[model samples]
Target: MSQHPAVTFRSAAVVLALALGAATPAAADAAPRSRPGDAVRSALDELAGGGEFAGALAAVREPGGRGRDYTAGVGDLATRAKVPVNGQVRIASTTKTFTAAVVLQLAGEGKVELDAPVERYLPRLVRGNGHDGRLITVRQLLQHTSGLPDHSKAIPGTFFDNRHRYFEPRELVDLALTQQPLFPPGKGWSYSNTGYVLLGLLVQKVTGRPIGAEITDRIITPLGLGDTYWPNPGEQRIRGAHPRAYKSRTGEPGGEPVDVSEMDPSRGWAAGQLVSTPRDVNRFLGALLGGRLLKPAMLEQMKRTVPVPGAPRGWGYGLGLTKISLSCGGLAWGHSGDVGGYSTRGGVTEGGRSATVTATEKSLTAEGDKRLDRFLDTALCAGQRPAAGQALR
Candidate 1:
């Protein structure tokens, strides 16, 4: 029941779908393919055709190659506009990976300590009902083991009702502080956007600059991610040509859908507010897993994972990245994100093969989520189709 829309989509159903079995064929014509990107495209086509999303876009970069892009459905359902192949979309919690990267970079520079208590940087700021900064380490925050309740879940409202509201990072943290911690720090695993808000505040306190600036200077700029950006306060429109976003009426089966493409994103903040294109997202994951974002030691530390109690089997939570053991054989590292009108999932393999897929709809039905996973698995496990009844790791 995390407030973030993405967390709702990450419920047990999606986890189980990702953990077991091969891609279930979307239709009778959906069959295995031999070409490089054909299987991946088929997966996208299946998702788009199933009527869960207005459109879908996917970008894939093979090892030592220029990459390919695929699109399915319409960008604008009203006008039947084709989905932009490299359009900008709100990359929700995936922003956590970028935030974690900046913090880890600070750790490498001796400016921050991963194991130090959060109080070491933001004293008194974390104190509240059953919550304490002294016992929570920076690593705990990055890894979602801080036990902080997500502020989004604490508040109640629809995207349209709160679109114009601006939330200070401290304000959001306070909302969570008003509630008891889910568990003692590091004693359990639970995703907490509030923990990342604290991390964002920590970055500002240490650097005397907004966390967005730190990410832009340290990661985005360095990687030449021209299409990625942190939207400023009150900015509700996505820059450049992009697909419109939609959300289910009540997030239930057959709920009415509405356009949520343009809404204030300040509420998401450091927790899940980044806007990026599929190409940029794929490049970022590629650079991150390819050892361009952090030092070897820090990157290894980031990869050290803990079991996610409710997540799918063979999946674990690392600092910010999610590690999934594919049924087709191989490990894929990346994250998934959800905001009001967008849903995105992407990953990078050890071989440098990377892919990112995005849909215009924010909340997906369980079956839709399964189709999305099938798309990701097909893309990442290209050419290595899993055999029938092969055990999924």
Candidate 2:
């Protein structure tokens, strides 16, 4: 089985969790300036001007305790519904952060083992090619070191074709397992949605409950993040005011915007099914890293994984955690999530100063993703006091 405390994957880098701490309450200052907001807004403006992203709303906080909110462009093309700072767009892969939290909570309860082999619970999850499930561990799945290929077979068709339908967790897992392994377990790292699908399965196997229930009970309810939710088909839109989401095929190929209100939530499931606002995400991150979620030992154990070459640096996985650096002063621990129509990054600083930013456009191209990171880095690090000679940008 893959070794414990060694995170060799990008998605499940749990070691990054160490960067998070207590949740600082919303800043005491008067209405914050739009500088931080503009940092992100300007980036989205550039993207939209170039016909890359339709629009985005970003919320950022200062390490010294200030916060700003920004809304740019329209949420929908035809309707002209202005994007709101509290937009309830689908968080896509950002949901994995919550999933990871539930898994870690289970581990803390002694119901799950971080380094246990996957076959110990989900024996039926076969690792295609010459690999076996026994060779993979729970940590490997969370860390994306399970060597399983992404849900390629299940995507570009299943998800795209039936974009409005709900997919059972088993269906996605089955589709992913049909693919060949990318490498021997723990030999290297790759981002795999399949690993997270299996993790959802493990949650169900051990708890005998749905992934939604587990998250609600373990993370949501306890934290009292009432605004956060995993809405069903009949209940898609954000409860009150929210930014409407827009979708287009691309710039050159240019297609009319789609409302995206009726998109499928099941395809993402435990992996990326969440729809939350910056306030809620920030609060959750604060509580999670503020010593409220897991015991010290369990939290440290979950944080033992980090990033390596071919993968982003500063990544580690305990359960479903991701550790990222500020490149300014402190580090942050949380997940970076995405789906076809949305992209999200949210994490709290080592002192619980947290931020969450989300966009409706895919920005899937290597170039676009990189640009998005630049925007995120600028917005996230703008308020922090520089560490030593480090530059904010």
The most accurate candidate by TM-score is: 1
Q: In candidate 1, what are the lDDT values of residues 151-245, reduced to their tens digit? A: 88666576677876888888888888888888999998777888889889999999999999999999899989998999987888999878999
Task: Identify the runs in model 2 with alpha carbons over 4 angstroms from their true place.
Answer: 1-50, 61-67, 127-131, 156-159, 233-240, 250-256, 311-318, 362-364, 385-393
Cand. 1 TM to true fold: 0.90
Which regions in candidate 1 have their CA more than 4 angstroms from the true location?
A: 1-37, 385-393
Task: Single out the weakest 10-residue window by summed lDDT for candidate 1.
Answer: 13-22
Backbone clash pairs in model 2 (N, Cα, C under 3 Å; residues 3+ apart or in different chains), count: 16
lDDT of each: 0.76, 0.62
Q: After superposition, how far is residue 126 of candidate 1 from its true place, in Å?
A: 0.5
- Lowest lDDT 10-mer window, candidate 2? 1-10
